[model samples]
Target: MAQDPPVSDLTDDQAALELQRLALVLSQANQAYHRDDSPSIDDASYDQLKRRNAQIEQRFPHLKRSDSPSDQVGAKPKEGFGKIRHRQPMLSLANAFEVQEVEDFVARLKKFLNLAPQSHMRMTAEPKIDGLSLSIRYEKGQLIHAVTRGDGETGEEVTANALTIADIPKTLSGAPDVLEVRGEVYMTHADFAALNATQEQAGQKPFSNPRNAAAGSLRQLDAQVTKARPLLFFAYAWGDLSEPLAPSQSEAVARLQALGFSTNPLFITCDTPEELVSHYGAVELARSDLGYDIDGMVYKVDDLALQARLGFRATTPRWAIAHKFPAELAWTELLGIDIQVGRTGALSPVARLNPVTVGGVVVSNATLHNEDYIAGRDSKGDSIRGGKDIRVGDWVQIYRAGDVIPKIADVDLSRRPVDSAPFDFAEKLKQEGIEGKRAPGDAVWRYCGDEPLADLAIEALKHFVSRQAFDIEGLGAKQIEQFYHRGWIRTPVDIFTLKSRFGPGQLQQLCNLDGWGEKSAQKLFDGIDAKRSIELHRLIFALGIRHVGEGAAKLLANRFVTWEALSEAMQSAAPGSAAAAALVEIEGVGEVMAQSVVEPFQDPERFAALQLLLAQLQVSPAPQIDSSTSPVAGKTVVFTGTLTQMTRAEAKARAETLGAKVSGSVSAKTDILVAGAGAGSKAKKATQLGIETLDEEGWIALIEGL
Candidate 1:
């Protein structure tokens, strides 16, 4: 695999390619780790890839792919097990590699909630168990189902196996009518060692690690097999609750304990980032001493209400982050440097190192990052590695962090070969017969050819039929590439028209192809036909518009309701116009993203293609929020001034839950305004616009009833 450049250094096209690669890689990694109970990559490497993917998506929002890794959790349930769809998705947490990132997480929360810097906030810090995630649901104080966190939305039914675990309660006393306790199922060090010993004595293959052992044991098809395995569960969170667990996260954990579930004893509340970091350090220091394996510390907003207000991203909670432990480091000799071309044609330098052990993993290659990095400088031309450039046969200090790709941390100048000289990256590229030039303001030297554009087109088509998009089964990436080269499928619309164009008696029939037989070709056509009607969000994502990722697509779909409405809104949204303002106001869609969303509608060629595509398919309207009982549902609301009843953040969150669109500024579109004691310009504007007005007390009364 080629080394990824910094998120800031990637061009839009490069970012899109990176997203596609990450999506594919991470999806496979997830299936291996979560569903198969076998991880192909180490934790550090997996985390690094996930982090890099997220950073790239963040930097190039418009180029975010529909199958982005950030929006996915776990993998599909393994075969041979009955599937159970979770009422609430078992979401993964965002990660923080550094203490500063924890601070940033806290800062983002405050900013999102419109909280003052001095406002009091609390977060709960707890050890992140390195084990399988399990969700045990209880109904009417009785255990109904126990499932593995297969994919976020669905899982493998393991109720019979769960009954064998002593730590897991068979039933709950005085619990909510519906409660889903989510936690980690782990094996202690002693148990793992004993289990491995038993396996070896029984002439069976021993497990690789405690986490894997626990997962394999818990997921066994035979309940008797699982009953013999020593397993423990620690409840940390809940899903699909009929009633609130508690006022805060810490209290919720206690509630779980009271309800006959085991909870981690180290879980505690912290008031500041410093305190959280201190707890992380304490946990890291105690990791070896603890019987169970722990990878990091998880920090979440303590207040349950605040967490609800903060809400969730596509696959992670906005109110929480996992602070991972530091990476392991080692030294190695730089044998050679190899340049690999990426999907977008950028030449990336990879350092070939002597096979050395780093954190118990054999390392042979490391990411050189770019030419600047190889020259012992950063992108801004600042000195790195003490201004000593790397050379062949030089001893270097390497660190394996959250990536399988180790990186050179420092040069052992004292041990450098006297005859060695600084390796010229440009000269090496030339010697490799790669001709390219680095564009101004770009760090990467991309291939100066039209081949990359063709690659991009194929990639775009692949994304169009991706699992998260149209999800046309039997038409995978390989098929897409083959079809592209064969001139059978050129565009998304062409995919829907395949049956018509390549059916029986046509000049070119898919069934006539060497590899594709009648049944397979018919199945392919059926797959294409099955996707002729797609949901609004999936269709928007299938368009592959810059900045309009799956999450953003869903937001737009929900906001506009229908395809025609969205098309009209974007087409009418001129620069600096009120329509543009409204487009940007859709939460998570800012100015740059808003511009990207409008560009397709403005472009003559793109707009015509879009119309043609629409003609080939039926796009269902966005899923409507069930707020039929609320009078303010689907209304635009603005809040200004000091409310006596609730905080502004609470008010906004409440309104949104009732299907009201909350806006910062008052406009002609404002449906109603709630005037508080210190109501200002917004209130006046609302009154002038003839929008319905109400007092703070009246506002509370209007939304009080169910």
Candidate 2:
């Protein structure tokens, strides 16, 4: 086996090349695992690749590729399974590879909740079983459907196969009217062995692993085939609940048990991080004895309220993390390095490795991060590989943990080829316009183009027409790219004017395009025409202002009520002015976000673009609910202090649904004040103004009829 090259051993050019290769290989592996369920590489190999990819990315931060594996989630869903969109995305958990990382996870959670160092924070630890993820939804206490966790947002419907499992409950005795029980569908070791034996006897291809066997069985087209397989479900979590089952994570698991579903018994509640880690060790020790397979232990914050406050990242929850066991390592030869450009103009490097198996999977690539990583120094300039740089043709050590990308651990000095040289990314690209530079506060060296604004135009347009934005159907990324290249859709306004300026002549030209027919061309024009009118929040989001995400845009829209009002405010709001303060006062808007919202409007070119866009469309005002029959309908309600029955956000959402206007302040306009415990000056002001004040119970009573 060839040894892995150390970062110190490689030059900048070599590192960039390695990162590029790693990106391609990891992407392929992810697809194989998520879509095909037949991973070409083992868990250990994949982890090593990912770790190496991350390492290189960190070292050469500027050269990070757009298609860097770190940015992606699970693979795309297969077409065979009927696509079912999840009500709430089924997100993946962040991983903690080391004991220290687990400790850091706990510490981070504690800090997020503003807990004292000695705070008796409780956590629930459970075995992360290696099986197919299943979501069984129940309506009116009866099983309605089941689906696979495809790419978090959408999954394949496997209702029939799920019904065949004995451990899944067909009907719940005392469950919420609407419940989504998410868990793993797995076959026991004994059953898997027997099934494989039977398959071998029948001269059929046996499953590669227990996880594969379970996934394949549950995803079978014929329900009878799934029934023949001894599959069992261990309900571990609940989603999209109509009502609360319990207040904490541990109690929720108990509720799942009481509701006639099989819950994992090994999961235990611990008040401290020590206990969680200790329990993890015990579980790891007993892995051989467990009936089913578990790759690692998962630790989640016990308090549901805290979990809610911690919220979520782009793809993982802040309250939970999976602590994977030690990864396996193998050696492979460094064949070459490559680079690829990202949407943000970062040039990322990847490693192409000679085929080598590690932890049951073959790894052919890994990530090399950026300039410094390939130079054998940490992002902070600390010596790595004893200050040795990795070079092409050198042997390298690779490691993998779970489904993470494989990483190069170190290079074996003895096996490095004598004639190998350092890599220079700038020289490789050979373009004066493409220069390497670091982003603000970023340690990586990105290969930035001279004209970043032009590069940003294409990505900006893509976001502008996305579902959450303009939602122009039939105008997908490919179509937008083509139109941009053809000078037909350079800006948002161009999309609206396509028919008026170009008309049938352009439509005929579009029809003559390779991928377009008469029907498709008409459909494209119709899509553009249908979006002549748009909601205020969507329009604000479509502008793609920095830090102005969907949520932030909604807040701005609701606060201002109309596009004209917001544009006027932004136009007049000088930095540190009262207008700027008002913009910041809106819920969820802070100084940074307020500045991001303002700076774009200050730009003459962007402001003109906005004007042109407005001239070509009719933007609607923010949502207004009016229910004439309801007492609180159209009435301004202010919720103060802690809400006992539900979260404050939930209360506000419910109130809005009932056609009531929820306000942040208590004043003469506040018709009703829903005061919970510990109500302060707002409650006093409401009382002073003779505004109707109601406790949690009273408020519930008032809304009961409505």
- Backbone clash count for every predicted candidate, in the order shown: 5, 70
Query: How high is each candidate's TM-score?
Result: 0.49, 0.47
For candidate 1, report its TM-score. Answer: 0.49
Q: Candidate 2: minimum summed lDDT over ten consecutive residues — where?
A: 1-10
Best of the candidates, lDDT: 1
Candidate 1, lDDT over the whole model: 0.82
Per-residue lDDT of 431-456 in model 2, one digit per residue for the tens? 43456676766655565555554445
Reference-based lDDT, residue 641, model 1: 64
